[model samples]
Each structure stands twice: as structure tokens, then as C-alpha cells.
Target: MTPTNILSVEAYFDLICPWCLIGKRHLETALGLLARERPDVTVHVEWRSYPLIPATPPDGIPYRDFYVARLGSPQAVAVRQAQVCHAAREAGLTLALDRIETFPNTLLAHRLVRFVRRQSGAEATAALIDNLFTRYFIRAQNIGDGQVLSDALAECGVDMPGASGTPVRHDLDWLPPLNGPDDLPPRTGLGVPHFVFNGTHSVSGSRPPAALLEAMQRALARAKQIATRTAA
Candidate 1:
């Protein structure tokens, strides 16, 4: 039987952030486990856009150079990359950060995700997201480039945004639910790959699948209690 209980999950993410990809994988695993354990509950995930570095030029900048400048040295950048690579391995992803030449601005990619989600729904949009991440992180493609993004979308059976003459809005201003002047979503408190369950219980970072499962269970219990009270 279809689960009558609905668990709303709002995940704030940025395409450029590796953690977001890893978190996505973990979340999927957790959801699978959730289905087995709680067949009475259905999960709904909304991928919210949270561009981490909006100031990046549309053309983007050298990936290595950007990190070196930000981290003060190539060694520091290497250290950070190593840490991420270790975490990536844990999530069954092998990141070739060095092969990635450009740290492309994610505005266009984010816009495409929104466009695809609106037109094709969540499953197609989810596939598009995976392809985009692979194109940039694995294939070393510059995702900010329309051609790269177009190619990725094609792989997922999606067309480029605005192809049908409908204008593709690059700006994220329409998502006014984000509080404050920064890109940080109020629910997340800080950083991408943040998850909010049922608009109340929130968990930040790329947590393990078990941790996510616990949070989901708690959110379900809390929501059940609320519904019971209201019914009475």
C-alpha cells in the first residue's frame, strides 16, 4: 500500500560543492533504508538552491588557483582536497579534483535544475543533478558553459533551459524563502547539503546514513504526535 504518512525533506545544496554530492548519495541510501523500515511513511525531497559562491564570474576561474589563493598555498589546497577525497571514497565517489580545470559558477547549473524540476519533476531533475556533478567532478567539464550543461542534460534526456523560447532566469530571487542577505537558508543555519525534515527537524553536513535515518525516524514520530493531537 502507498504510505499515507508524508515526510517532507528540504535539502539546501550547491552544484559546485562536493559535499552536496556526497550528502545526496548518503541521503538516497538513508531513504532506501527508510522505505524498508517504515513502509507506512513516504519521503518527499525538495532540492533547494544555495549557491555558495555567487561572486564567481560566469566564465569561472582556474580551479587550482582559486583554492591556492583562498587557502594561502598549494599545500593547503592539497590538504583540503585530500580530506574531501577521503570523504568521497566513503560515499563511493572518486573525485579527481586536480583534473577539474575550472571552478565554474553554478548559476546556470542551478537554473537548469530548477527548470528541469518544474518541467520533468523530481526523478528527471535528480538524474540531471547526478550528470552535472559527474561532468564537472569526474569528466572535468566546465559546467558553467552552456555546451557542457547542455551535454549533461542530454545524457539525462533533458533539453537545455530556454530551448523552447521560454526565458531561463539565472537569478535566484524568486526563492524568497531564504532569509538574510546571504545564500544560507535559514533552516540550515550554515553550509550546503543541509537537510530539514518536515520543516522542523534539521541536520547539517554530510552525515552518515544511520544519522540521517535516525533524524527521519524522529521527524516522523514528532509529526505523528502532532497529527494525533490535532485530530483529537
Candidate 2:
């Protein structure tokens, strides 16, 4: 197939969401599995932004309390978190929920990611995303602080303010509504870590890579059928 015939998928995610991280890993695993079977098909990805808890305060708040109030009772929250932790471990990922004191506004982090995207391609962007997750989930670092972000960016060879010149802060207003055409409404106006495949099919929440791969294959197949019909 021609390069134009290749498939492209856009993913919307937030760094703070544990399920998003698991979903990402599962997608990667699915891609690797697909590669072994079909090497000819090219799958391209674009990352978008979706803040799960946009109101997350700076300096961080107690994540446990936040979940309890937002989700249910403290005991219920703990149980839910345990389930997530198990899922993460099953996915070969370590989730340090204790370290996440509060969910900071991820607008700045998303901007930094966009900046990294500009400096490096998708692979680099993916690496940076993974690194950010590791820093929070594994190291339990405070990612809400500018200094912490600058340090992380610097480690990735990404230039940030304070390190070189002025520090760059993200504009939250401009951060959202970054997905598609200027007029298209956002999918899952509330849910985060949304994945839109071929700009047609959208999967809300973090899904397994097998699900994503299947979505891509379906999109590709439909496109091919349309092309064949038009030609015939």
C-alpha cells in the first residue's frame, strides 16, 4: 500500500491517570504483536490532550481523598486503586500511587510534551511520555513543579525555561480543543485518555492494544474497500 494508504491513530491522554498508562503499554504490546504478523502495514500515531482532573490544585492535594470524594468512600477508593495496581503489575508496570499526593494541573505537562514533539519526532515523544510516567509512578517525583518539569525536559535534551532562558509555561486555554478541525466537537467531553482512530472511531478510556489494533485494522479495511469500489 502507498504511504498515503497507511493508517494514523490519534490518542488523547493525561500523565496522571494510571489507567491511561496501562492502556498505553497494552497498545504498544498489541502493536508489537501485530508487527510480527503484518509488517507491511504502517501504523502512525498522534497524541492529544485530555485532563482527567482538570481542577487538580497545584502543590498537590491528597490523591486518596480526591478519589474518595470523587469516586466514593475511602474504602471504595482504596479497593479501586488496588484493582488498578494489579492491572498495572499485570501489564509489567509499577504504579506508585502513594507518591501521587495530589493531581496537579497537567496542562503545563501537556504543553511540555507538545514542545518535545516539536523538537523530536513521535518516537522521541513516546519516550518522553514513558519517562514522565516513570518519574511519577516509579520515582514519585513532584511533576507539578516547574523545576521538576525543567529537570525532566533537560534529561531528555529538551530545552526549557530557567535552564537556558525564561521558563515557558503552558497556556491552559489553548491546551484543550487541540484535536481536529477548528469546529469539530471533542469526544467524551468529560472522560480522559480518549483515543480516536482514523479521526472516525473513538475509544474512551485506556484500552488494550489489541482493541486499538483491531480498530486500526477495521479502519484500514474499510478505507481499502471504499478505494476498491471507487476504482471499480
Candidate 3:
């Protein structure tokens, strides 16, 4: 496709994060809107793994207890859950937080994504990511389990590597430093559901579809402007 004909979106997310799941839904909605309104633009999305809790044991920790400790109190956790649930409902997703039992370390989960992307392609990798988020958040399955990850790969029409028993180590040192709008200084902390549009503009958090759509448009326009200047 020509430069103007394509739009690139890079999404940084983690499977165990409820907000990332909600953000995925919102991003999908925004893509659909782009498809309907801007048929001439072919969007390519690249999913980058960002493990929220990389230190948790592979076997996992009790979900409720982990959150309770993280939030400092049951009441605080409840309030946070309510807020997440409301946002999830708005995005047409159901947060089954109660169904979750274990809070798994997502190192393996992210490795699985990279494996799928290398083997099949970005499309299959995206499918695997969606499946994983559903399994973790909605189905409340232990995503860190080797068998579970193997099964998830199979569901996405990917082959289970023979080395599945061995944990795959990933190097995330290549991730670009996050820089926000011009007026705002670069953020030192990383956040889930972060989006980079055409590698030129970025939006953070689980923003609404409208906001994401605007980011995409702005990125596309900026790209075209640069391309035009270059062609001149």
C-alpha cells in the first residue's frame, strides 16, 4: 500500500490487566469506525507485550489476596472493582473479577504472544491476545500455566512448540521511551493499554473510542503532511 493508504497502530498491553482488556475493546471499536469511515486507509496494528506483574510466581498468587494487599484494604479493592466494572460495561465487556482465583506472572503469556507473532503473523498474534485476555479476565483461567498457554495457541491455529515446558525469556529493552504531548513532559512510568499511532503520536490508558479515533486521525494526518513535504 502507498504511504497514505496505510495507518500503523502500536498497542502495549498486559493480559492480567482488566483495563487492558477494556482498552482492547475500545481500540477494536475505534478500528471498526475507521474501517467504515476511512475505507481507503488500511490499518496495521502491532501488539507489544507489557507485563503488569512480572514478578508473580509462575504458579501464581491468590487473586483476591493479591489485590487486597495491593490496594491496602478490601474496601479499597471493592471501590476499584466497581470503577473497573462500570468502565467495562461501558465498553460492552463483563468483568468477572470474582471468577478469577490466581494472579499469574505474565512472562510466559507474553512469550507465547511473541512466539505466535513470529510463527503465524500479527493477525494470529492479535487473535491469541484477545483469547488470552478473555481466558484470564472473563473465564478466569490460569494463563501462566504451560498447558493453558499451549491450548490457547492451538485455539488460534498455532502449533505448540516442543520447548513449551521451558520458560521463554523476553528482552523488553527495545521498547521506546514514552513521550506524551509536546506541552507535557515524557512519562517515566509505563501504563497498560498504551497506544502509539504510526509511531508519531501516542495515547495512554483505556481512553474512550472517540479519543482513540482522534489519535489515529491525527497520526494519519501528520504522516501525510510529512510525506507531502518530503515529496516536495
Candidate 4:
């Protein structure tokens, strides 16, 4: 029998990015495909943090206005959203893009996810991530709002007892603790929803399942080769 090789996947993402959610779905699909094809390879995923809009106001700005300004017009925003919606549908996700109201500073939300991972476990962490994204993208709730976050925490069975309950200052200049060699080259010109396998194979953006599956196979193969060389 062939010995199984473990592949470490570090997924750097932020809750505010809808593409990240789509990437999550794609990764899950890729893992399922990988299991059938490469039973000798096992995957271990680590969800890491990457804040997209760290400068957002603590109270958050209007989502529609922000996108309109960034995209240059309401019409442009609609076109961009349509593009996202088309991609979301392909990923088996339904995103009510117009339902979103706030472009939030996601510092607290990211911290809360880290908290869940540390206290509850992987299942709880996934549940909380979905809860936050559902509330924000589907229901269009303000994730920066204390009430929204409080409800999500309760639903996820996370007990963050000592939370200050005060608003996070947007200018706090905080950064999440990063690990491994997942950083993409500057030439890539992309952010969030990045996947790194075996600390070497990395891809950015919302890749299709087949592409992701290919990366996993290549990474695992390289890992086994390195292992064989190290043992020799």
C-alpha cells in the first residue's frame, strides 16, 4: 500500500470579499475531486486572514456609494456586480449584491473568526464564516454593526466573554499574524482568495475547481518528491 502524503493548504481570505466565498466553494469542490483521484494525498487547510479594506470607517460606509465611486458610476457598479453574480452562480452561490448596504472595516469580524477557530474548532469556524457572509451578502446586514456580530456569535456557539463591546477604531493600524510563504508576487496584481499548497504552489483569485484540483495534485506530487529526496 502507498503511504499517504499530507498537503498543507493556506487559504488567505477576508469576509468582505464575495469572491473569497466563491473561492471557498471552489476549494471544497476541488477537495472532493482530489479525494476520488488521489487517495494517497491528504489535505490540511488553514484559513488565514487578509483584510481587503482596512481603512473602512468603524461605522462603515454605504456599500452602494463606495462601489459606485470606485467603479465610477452606478451603472458601472451594476455591470461589475452582474459579473460577480454570474461567477457566483457558477460557484453554486447566490449573492444578492444590491442587498449589501455597508462596506465594512472587517477587523473585528476577522478577529471573531480567529477566535472561533481557536475556541470552537474547524466546523464551528466554517459555520461562523458562512453565517457572516450570509448575513452580509444575502440578507444585506451590516457586518460592522454590533447587533449583527452579536447575533452571529450566538448562533455559532462562540462565547467571546471579554469583548470590549466598544467600536474598533479604524485607524488602529493592526495586522493579522501571517504564516508561511503564501504571498503572491507583485506582478500578480491580485488580493484575497489566494490558495497556497505545500508552501510553494500558489494561486490567486477565484479559480475554478478543475484548476484548483490541478494545483493540489502538482503540490502533492512535488511534496512527495521532496520527501523522497530528504529521506535518501
Q: Compared with the true structure, what per-residue lDDT tens digits does model 1 show for residues 1-232? A: 3223789898888889999989999999999999999887867787777888878998999999899999999899999999999999999999989899998888878877876777788889888889988888888889888767767776798654364798643443332333333334674346878999987688889999999999988888888788778779
- Candidate 4's C-alpha runs over 4 A off are 1-4, 162-190
Clashes of each: 0, 3, 0, 0
Q: State TM-scores per candidate.
A: 0.87, 0.84, 0.87, 0.85
lDDT of each: 0.82, 0.71, 0.82, 0.79
Error of 3 at 6 (Å): 1.2
The TM-score obtained by model 3 is 0.87
Q: Please write out the lDDT profile of model 2 over residues 88-156, one tens digit for every residue.
A: 998998788876776666656776777677668788788788878888777887677666776677677
Angstrom error of the Cα, residue 218, model 1: value is 0.7
- 155-187 in candidate 3: lDDT tens per residue? 888755343675432333222332223212234
Model 3: lDDT to the true structure: 0.82
Q: What is the lDDT of residue 123 in candidate 4?
A: 76
Model 1: how far residue 97 lies from native, Å: 0.6
User: Residue 170's C-alpha lDDT in candidate 3?
Assistant: 32
- Candidate 3 — worst ten consecutive residues by lDDT sum? 175-184
